[model samples]
Target: MVLEPIYCPSCTSTNIVKHGKSTQGKQRYKCRNLDCSRSTFILRYSYLGYLPEVKQRISEMAINGSGIRDTARVLKISPTTVIEELKKRS
Candidate 1:
């Protein structure tokens, strides 16, 4: 069996344990990094889109003068998503 690399989106910590399943039957994982802000995470699109890496990329692209529409197009996400991410960073 292939082992999946589970990481804490907040701190990028791979020290994680199976937390349980979500109500929707998704696999949940708890981060072992005490310094991490996020406690648990589910490997899903909705959650993945909100990961720190994604957020950082959003900021980087924005700072590089990328428009929200262009960022969304390149990121394969929604412009609303780009806007929301920028809002959070600001």
Candidate 2:
């Protein structure tokens, strides 16, 4: 078996360790970097709203004059997800 190194997506640090399993049984990882803004993250997310590209699209759609409902509809996510993302961005 080959061991692959895991890097923190936020800080790009290779000081990551297994935290636990998620509700869907995916392995969750925690960053050991104290200065990293993000503490934990999963490499692959099952939900569209949880993906980084989708999150960026959420903000982009909002900035491009798309309403929350439209953004959510186009992204196939919930309106609450768009709202929450916008709130976080602001």
RMSD of each: 3.1, 1.6
Off by over 4 Å in 2: none
Question: Which parts of model 1 have CA positions greater than 4 angstroms off?
Answer: 1-15, 22-24, 44-48
Q: How do the residues 1-90 of candidate 1 rate in per-residue lDDT, one tens digit apiece?
A: 998788787799999999999887888899998899999988784544566677788899999999998888887778898898888778
lDDT of 2 by residue, 1-90 (tens): 999888888899999999999999999999999999999999999898998889999988888899999999999999998999999999
Q: Which ten residues in a row have the lowest lDDT in candidate 1?
A: 45-54
Task: Please give the TM-score that candidate 2 achieves against the real structure.
Answer: 0.84
Candidate 2 residue pairs in clash (backbone atoms < 3 Å): none
TM-score list, all predictions? 0.69, 0.84
Q: For model 2, how big is the CA root-mean-square deviation? A: 1.6
